[model samples]
Target chain A: MKIICNGTEYEVGQGTTLLHFLAQLQLDPDTVVVECDTEIIRREAYEGTLLAPGQNLELIRFVGGG
Target chain B: MRIMVHEQEREVAAGTPLSEIAASFPGSDLFIVNGCQVSGAYQPREGDGCWCLRKGEMIQEHELRRLLSLRHTPGVQEVISRAVVGIMGLGGLGSAVAGALARIGTGRLILADYDIVDPTNLNRQHFFVDQIGMKKTEALAANLRRMNPYVDLTLHDCRLTAANIPLLFAGADVLVECFDDPVLKAASFRLALTDMKTMGYVGASGMAGFGDNNLITTVAHRPSVFIVGDGESEAKPGQGLMAPRVGIAAHHQANQVLRILLARAGMLMGL
Candidate 1:
């Protein structure tokens, strides 16, 4: 299935969990805030959340510089 | 009738127009009532608060406010003057951001940073050569006070962790993420989006080195969350943080912050 993340579409396994999907992208679940379909998924919910085709995800990572 | 004019109680007629009060002060061109600008024809009731702006005067707090008010229309200046912004770091971005906000008359600033000014920071940070040994919080606070003494400043001289981030910036209407550590940045970003959802957020990323200035930009990742910078450059061996590029990103964060605060108060003017 294809899921939209940060305005880009990515193909993932059929039943990929949000946590597993983050790992595939090489993103630490603790570092990025995931907004799935307009609702913010809690840190703990990343494992239970499932990705469906065409689902919109906004991933905001905190990269540092001042 | 009793009314407070410039914090002093004075007597006026029961239905005296604000214009009459303004006329009492020579060279005055602006008038504020109850924290909002009012037309000269508007009459003041008993105990109404009032302020009259006179030209060529430098009366500390009131004068600073008057000067800022001149640049913005009525309530726009008032909204900015009443805002409280929290800055999380005191480096290149946070220092410049605070300086801009102070000059613009942001009512209160909550500044947090555990670091001290280093000789190496003179390149982009706002500290002077003599301030190298001083704490960044103290040095920045002193500089901000010099820029605008009327602005209220709250300084935290300790390092901020996810556990204390929310409490440190509790009353801030907007939070600007300016940390230099990726770990702290991520922690604060997650909390701002989740726990402190009510406050607006502006964070920076990838502004380092002497690359193309035009490449630096601001992006709205969420409704109230903004990220500024190229999102690519990093400060490494050959590349380092400089004033021009870092300042560009800093002002972007500052400008985005003003946009959020002004929009919240329904006074976002222009584009």
Candidate 2:
């Protein structure tokens, strides 16, 4: 299954959760806030929510400023 | 005797004795001693062969110590040190926030408060009984300097006023809104938002009351901000700020600052 994340495409296996993919990419969970499609995934829900194929994901990390 | 100092492919001649050779290159901190990896220390032998001192190579002990002391990430340190961070109200939340940033090597800190350290503050403010009569900023800066001699700290021994808000945060990189008063908190938010365009600053609110561990949440993004200690959450009207809860929130705030700075430098992984 193909999913787009941060403008990059990945061929993921079926029933892959966003959290699982993030872990596979070695992304730091503490640094990033993940949004699946248009909805923001609460930190508590990252572990449980599975990603559907062709999903558009946005992963934004915190940077310096106010 | 002539020694060779290599920087990339460029090699320059260094005088006899390692000390003399090292003195010649004023800006180069990295060095190589003999054939082994050494930094900051090099003693020349009587029968000296061509000793090579190269940038990015190991150095003798003396030089090594100096190099180690010099912050390699100068740009990051400069930004942190020169940047002013306003922490409102030096109570439990303010105390923790001030100390954490000072200890972590923030160059300059602006601590604002109008309270005296009360006897009760000892419970969580990390202050001694002798500090009760002293102003919060004075005591806090004293403690902060003791924690990190490198930090430059300033104190505003007064309340946050609308008139002084601009002066208080003139060059501040970020404003940490730890005031317990809801009115002041709202005021600070307004001040930050209005000046953010001019000062390039942002703020975090919501650290008050108790159950600190539960109150804390890590919020990241460009100009990362956090609201710690459930200030927005319900708490008893008369209940004062607890140490553990306020301390946890303060820690979260400090960590977010450091993480934001690191992220900006592209040095941190896992925002």
Candidate 3:
């Protein structure tokens, strides 16, 4: 299925959880806020939330530097 | 058609651009339309209102609060005065954000930072030479007091860990993450967003170096979560953080803070 992450389209396998998605992208769950289709997904729910086709995800990464 | 310019309503052509209206009233330092900054080329629709702020105006201290209230959209300053904003870092972005909030009469601020003012921070951080060696919380609090003595401040001079983040900023209406360390920055923001779900989050990333001011911007990851910065620049060996770029991001964070507060108060319905 294709899902949009941070404005970019990506194809992931079926039933791909947000946690696995982050691991594939090398993004630590503790570092990024994931918004799926305009709703912020709770950090604890990352494992249960499945990425659906055409889902618009906004992943805001907190790097550094003031 | 009629549009508001400050306290008075002015008759203007149906599609008169904001630039022409602004030009009619000379010496205005800042222009705000419908509670947000708009380009001068913007064409104001009927019923759209604006405030054209002028600099160097003298007013008594007792009148300061009243004047500030009058300058903004009606009842907006009241919303600002009831907000409690938390700042997690006291570096360039944090300091400028704090200063802007203080100047605008934010009700309270919760400041947390472990570092002290160092000589290298002079290029971007909001500290004077005399403040060197002083804890950032103390130095920033002192400076903020000068801007608005009435604004309440709570200082936590210790480093805010993921464990202490929730407790330190329990009453904050919003939290701004402005850490300089990548690991700590990511950790703090994650903690705030997950642990403090009630408070809005404004985190900055990739605000470094100079040139291309437009690259720095504000993005809403969620309705209550905002991130401001270029999303790519980093303070590396050759490219260091400068005041201009850092200040721009800081102001964006500060503005987002106000917008969130006002939106929560039912003032800015557009947000």
Best by TM-score: 1
Off by over 4 Å in 1: A14-20, A28-30, A44-55, B1-59, B269-271
TM-score pick, better of 1 and 3: 1
**Clash list (residue pairs), candidate 1:** none
lDDT of each: 0.86, 0.61, 0.84
DockQ of 3: 0.36
List the candidate 2 regions with Cα displacement exceeding 4 Å. A1-66, B1-79, B198-212, B219-225, B234-239, B266-271
- Which segments of model 3 are wrong by more than 4 Å? A1-30, A33-58, B1-61
lDDT of 1 at B239: 81
Best by lDDT: 1
Taking all chains together, the TM-score of candidate 1 against the true structure is: 0.77
lDDT of 2 by residue, A1-66 (tens): 899998999999988877788899886554345667756665557778888888998875432111
TM-score of chain A of 1: 0.90
Best by DockQ: 1
Chain A only: give the TM-score of model 3. 0.92
Poorest stretch of ten by lDDT in candidate 2 chain B:
B1-10
